[model samples]
Each structure stands twice: as structure tokens, then as C-alpha cells.
Target: MIFSRITEVLTHVGVITLLILLAVTLVYYPEFRLVVFLTFIMVITLTVYISRRAARKPPKLFDVIADEVRRGSILFEVDDDEVSRLLEKDFTLYEEFRKQSYKALLESVIIVPIFLWYFIYFYLILPRFVITDLNLRLIAYIIGFVVPYILYLASELVFRVKTLTYVLRGYEVYDRGIVSSSQYIVIKFPLSKDYLVREYSNRKCVELSRKHGRYTVRFLLYTKNTPKLTETLSNYGKAEVISS
Candidate 1:
């Protein structure tokens, strides 16, 4: 009974609470710190086990959507295979975006801890430098921090550009939304929402607006991919042909 209650409590406690509990235990209950740490590990392991079990038991979101469409409960004209393909494409794009975002974030922050260590190391070793003057040692210390910081800034800019470029080209279209690709900008237009579509001679553009048109996003699709995408979106939206 006690273990079950503990499990229930820990399951309801959020990540912040868990962190706070660990910190408090480390500071105030040194004798029981090892036990508390083991408990935390067990909680994480249980959570992972539960998550994997749930994942394995699913009719999955895509499968449900496809089933609903097949039964004519959802009025989409797409077949189950098309629905599956589109959902898979969206999932793949989302996963790619998620991974690239994690990489960019990791790259941006990895330098921080390393340079923090450098700052401390340089400050501690100030006296051992050949320049014995206090002023020179101070300058050296500041330089050590400033140079790495500048390099970090440059790396952050580069990663930001790379991430942006990756999203701005190779645009993708599906039943729910369009995925823009390339180097500068990425836009997603959901067909379920109110949107505007404009077609040019060689390309097509999708515009989605929200908050009474207070915010808008537009993306272009090349001519080659327009037909299938237009067919998919026709039931939800219409396109306007633009004169040259």
C-alpha cells in the first residue's frame, strides 16, 4: 500500500517538483540522499516503462484518422493509403525539424559550460602567467572570456542560418498543411483554417491568416507539385489565378 501510494504521488508530481525534492533532500537529508536519488531513478524508469507500454498499445493517431475517413465520418476525399502517406510525411518533417532544433540548441549551449570552465580556470591561474603585473593579468582574464564568447556568438549565428536554410526549401504539401523548405523562411498553411491561395504561371502560393488577419504566413509551391496538392486542398479551399 505504501509503495503504491508513493508511486501515485510521484507520478502526479511534475518535473519541477521532482527537481526541487531532489535538491531539498540533498541539502537537508544527507544521510538519506542515496535513497532519495535511487527513488528518483526508479520514478524515471517507471515513467519510461509506462510510456513504452502505452506506445505499443496504440491504434495510433494516423490509424484512427484513416479509419474515420474510411467510414465517411470525416468528409475528406482521400483514401486510407493517401492519408497514411500524408501523415507519415508530416511526421517525418516534424521529426526532422525537432532533431535539427535539438542539434542547434545543443550546439549553441555546449560552448557555454566549456567557456565557463575556461573562465574559472583562467581566473585561478592568473598569477602564473609571464605577465606578472596585475593589470596585464586582469586583461588576460577578460580576453580569455571575451574571445570564447565572440566565437560562441559566431557559431550561434551560423547554426541559426543553417537551420533557417534547411526549412525554407524542398517544400512539402499534404492534406492538413503545406511544409515549406529552403534556406531562409518556412511557412505552414493548414487547410482546415481559412486561407487564401494564389496561382502564378510557374508557381502557387498559400496564405494563412489568423486572429482576424492580424497575423499571416505565405509559402510558395513549385509548379511540379501543385496539381496533387491542389487536389488535396480543393475540398477545403479554392485558388485564384494571378494574371502576369
Candidate 2:
């Protein structure tokens, strides 16, 4: 397992390293950069395909839940809509949480500088680097701008699709447990009385505590109907609301 994970990490790093190298090379050799641009597209397409395949693979937690379900141990199941709603709520809360973090500030610092560098290098320096006809240089400039933007849009699309797939999975609240998964489960745990239900960013979240671990599951954003879900969970176990 460790070896496979290492291999996957290396594969991703290698792809990124190659792309960076190609981008740098484009600065010096703008003539044949179109070919490099096409190669970049191909690489990105393959990466997205591989990522989607990996996403479909069942997580280890699913195996444990399958065994339990086979033994008729599951008591109740939550619909996919409820799971998705909760996940969306959590995503919003997480975004708000992230915005307040030092890491977010650091990311902005790093990303903004890199973007500025790319714009200056490609738009100004790259055109000057071109030792060819004005028309060809114009084409190079267009390719330089379009390729990166296309890559960025494609990457965002992949991320959104992956997140959507994850949250759309049906969840099961077993006789004594719950499994979090859409297609492949990643978490399964027994319910604990020490759990807390709280509101954060106008969303409901339940923090489940077990003998040796804790997991927090988020629910829908606060609305007129939010109390219904909270009331249902409260009926099953101890629940308390605290500040975000």
C-alpha cells in the first residue's frame, strides 16, 4: 500500500515538474511551443482520466462496512440528498474557515506572485523572445495565454466533479454505526453518546466520538428545515448546540 501511494505521488509530481519545465522552455523557444502546448493538453487529459479512475476505487473503510451489512447489521440508512446537503454545508463552512487561516494568506502571497510573473513573462518577455515574423509572434502570444487558462479551467472542473461525486453517495446509519461514502466508503464508526451537534457557518455538524477516535460530520446549512434533521439526531442520542 505504501509503495503504491509513493508511486502515485511520484507520478503526480513528475507530471507537474514536466509542465513547469515545458513552460520555462517556452520562454526560450517560442517557435515550436505549439507542439509543447498540445503535449500539455494531452498530459492534462490523461491525468484527469487517471484521477477519475482512482476516485472510483473503493476505500478500505467500505470493505469493513460491507462485511457488517452482509451480516444484516445495518439499522438505518440516510439518503444521498441528505448526505450531499450536509457535505455542501460543510464545504461552505470549510471555505469560511480557510479564509481566516494563515495558510490562506500564505497561499495568496505565493499564488499572486506566481501569476504576476507568468503574466509578465508570457505577455511581455515572451513576445520579445520570439525571433520570427510578427504574425507568428502574435500566434505564440495567443497560445501562451490560452493554454494556461484552459489548463486552469480544466483543473477546476475536475475538482468540482470529484467533490460532487463524493457528496452524492448514500450514507447508512447502522444499528450502532454510520459509513461515509458515495461510491466507496472512506469512514465507518459506531455511534457514541459523547457526540456533539453544533452550528458553524449556519450549518449543522455532528462530532462523533468513539472509544479511540472522533469524526465530525456536517449537515445542511441553517434553514427553516434545519431543525428537523437536528431533532431527528437528537432523538437517537445526546446532542448539544454550541457556538461556531
Q: Count the backbone clashes (under 3 Å) in each candidate.
A: 7, 1
Top lDDT: which candidate number?
Answer: 2
Q: Total backbone clashes of model 2?
A: 1
List all candidate RMSDs to the true structure.
13.6, 9.9
Model 1 local distance difference test score: 0.43
TM value for model 2: 0.38
The digit string of per-residue lDDT tens for model 2 on 62-123 reads 33654463343554556766656666656664674555354334422433443565558666
Model 1 alpha-carbon drift over 4 Å, by segment: 1-84, 89-99, 116-120, 123-125, 161-244
Deviating ranges (above 4 Å) for candidate 2:
1-5, 20-31, 48-60, 65-124, 129-244
lDDT of each: 0.43, 0.49
Tell me each candidate's TM-score: 0.33, 0.38
